[model samples]
Target: MRTLNNHKLKLGILDQSALMPGDTPTDAFRRTIELAKLGERWGYSRFWVSEHHDTPRLAGSSPEVLLGALGAHTSRIRIGSAGVLLPHYSPFKIAENFRVLEALYPGRIDLGIGRAPGGMPIASQALRYGRTKPSDEQLPDVLRDLGGFLADSLEPGHRFEGVRAAPFVETKPDIWLLGSSSFSAERASELGAAFSFAHFINGDGGHEAVKGYFDSYRPGPLGSEPRANVCVIAICADTDEEAERLALPVELALLLLEQGQFQRPFPTYEEALAYPYTEWDRMRIQVNRSRMLVGGPVSIREQMLNFAGDYGVEELIVVTFGADPAARLRSYELLAQTFELA
Candidate 1:
């Protein structure tokens, strides 16, 4: 991997608002707030919540709503959606929601939008509420409207010429396009928006995707220079063995999820350990492990720094998964110290 001696790497967090078995959604919300506060104190650059629907394991179905509470609880760290599922909602409404957040916490909100459905068809249909499913071809138009609304720059002859995402704050939330492939990278570049690659979801082809974004990038509202970040699953501990132990739950969760077993509140480590596994299951775990960064602090730091350098990105957004909330927090704490984030 390439090395950048002068680059100052940045660290951010992506919370899924994971629900432990027997934990209520209310408890999950409180935990997210607590984690945000702790992350701020620990020197994380940003605290982002993800959107998921019809999944009991993830309580953060409405990242915009959670972002409001996170902004209220944390004084400094930037708060945002890991992303909002753009296809299900109106671009106008999405702009207004983040605009309200920016109005409340100017210069500290990020609006990360994605084209994914974020859930099963049933839940997705409910979100659309009888509306037609948005096609991939519509993303460019959706992004155009979203940007226009945020910047108050809708061109003449546009359908919503007079419409505005009101409360028109001077500082709009920073906008980012989130995706697991080059499609979003190209779109973000075309729109001149910041791009975040979801490496945790799809680790393959990331190099080409990042390169595409950088090559096609143009100056826009966020800044004159190109900006991008890689989001990945990272779990760190004092020792490699312990870190691996802590990561078992998520590994098993992903494996089962791939097998079409959507168990909510994720299985505990003991449960995962107790379950019988065949050779194929073990192989599948190894395959899924390719997308994660798991190890002790020193190892994780070295790997993540190399990952950032290789991708030519200075920022890394980490998502930690485990049944124990304390273990999750500890993982971030270790990473914060390892990266010397502030």
Candidate 2:
């Protein structure tokens, strides 16, 4: 296992393709593409995008489709899904989609799979076309099947054992189990797939979850060695106050999510900052903010390293997807500069 060093800590980006009031989905995607290019030039290790189906606030609906575009735009940085909602699609289809990407980019793709619907209940229904079974219940079996498809190692006599995910290439995308809970960590450990805990989504129990993963890791079809990272929401500015200011909108966004308004458009910077925070809202922000690393470059770098060290991982996929676009870009630039990634 590799020990994390602050000076050598690797950072990656997780973009949700969020949109403000005036921006169209196209504008958001273009920004995501440009962000990947900048991330590569800035020496970030991996650039991953998230999927949110038919959400007005976010544009990225299909990471595999988006990754194809991202793979063409950048050369050195690894491009990936943060991930794709695996339950809505077939493992064989996903295997073939990423196989096509691997054929194109050859060693620079990652396929992060999540069990969550990644959208509203109605949207999930539409996506499923009336499939009744719950995805969470079936995710483990799906993951195992996907591992076999990716490795061409389906057990003899099993259905689809000899079938190939077409356009097979020498390289394969890194398979990752992405989740915010111990269930995913345990599964990833059992299957030997890469694990990325969504710390931004669920802040508690992460250290325990990740520790369990490393301690109980076993070699499997997807990977022999344990690979892990934590995704964190961070906001960096020139000062602590500015960072807090930029975090307001995101805090409000999460608050809305908590209130069952998961897919509404993000509030504007002015709206969030100026909105009156009730006692409950303030308390929620306090809880949400505790998981975030928001400060200037120096403080952010220290907090990020401490986070990675606690999780026992060397890399942190940093998500600075604040409400401000220019500020978001500056956050990465400052982080790359502060960490000397470039």
Candidate 3:
């Protein structure tokens, strides 16, 4: 793998559009647009939103719709799905959806695709609506079809030959494969697409998965050189203590999620501070800490850079979660200044 000590790293933001108690979906969307605008001003490279289904705490179920809104509201920043769950939808439809966004926004669009169900099994079943589903092993074929539609390069004699995702615009959205495992890395490499390893979701596999991507990469339409990034949970505050305090709500929320308490919104810091915790809860938090980077500006900057170096990637996508929108916004601001973005 190639690593450069003096590489100028870029930063991107991933918004889950978390809906806390008393917050409506409308409020969540407004905040998403507001954050995208701020992210552009802060010089972040791209602003991506995630898709979640049947989750009351996450308001973003349709990233394509939100990407249209984001593109409309922000003039400079690149907007995309962090990504769209490919398994639940048709490849041609996904290509068409993003193609429309690309036609509307031209050069400022992206289409990050992933194989995850993006929700519980019941929700996944609902997404399929009783249709016979493709096996998990067929994800590669799905990706290939999606790429074919996007690139206008379906192979001769293919089943979907000549079925192009229209309006046939000159500019196509950049496509990336999102994953947290070696399977995704290998698939991305085999397909010659940009890869984003989800370190925030699975921290332990990143270094090895990234290495595997580099080793197996082949030149294709995305680019000859391997393009990859590591996505991680990050929070920054003026002081280390304050940063830890700010992280408490997300920590507790994740613990609850692990304990099968779905649909619960993030709690306030005060609530998290006062909540009684079991020894198991404390242990879960400690174990999950490895996946996050939480500290003051100095420490956060240092750790982010270290992660970039370790992963051999020059770009890092930061995903922040909090009950307070202001805290989440401030965390990105601090990171932007710390890295001197733009």
Please count the clashing residue pairs in each candidate, in the order shown.
0, 0, 0
Candidate 1 lDDT at 341 equals: 73
Q: What is the TM-score of each candidate against the true structure?
A: 0.96, 0.96, 0.96
lDDT of 1: 0.88
Candidate that scores best on TM-score: 1
lDDT of 3: 0.88
TM-score of 2: 0.96
lDDT tens per residue, model 2, 1-342:
345665678899999888877888899999999999999999999999998886778888989889989988898899999887887888899999999998999889889988888887889889889766445666777888888888788889988878989897877889889999999899899888999999999999999999999999998877889989999998888887888788888888888888888656787788787878899988998998866898898888778877787788988999986667899899889889888898
User: Can you list the residue pairs that collide in candidate 1?
Assistant: none
- What's the lDDT for residue 258 in model 2? 87
lDDT of 3 by residue, 219-276 (tens): 7654456889989999999999989999998898878888888867688899899989
Q: Give residue 221's error in model 3 in angstroms.
A: 5.8
lDDT values of the candidates? 0.88, 0.86, 0.88
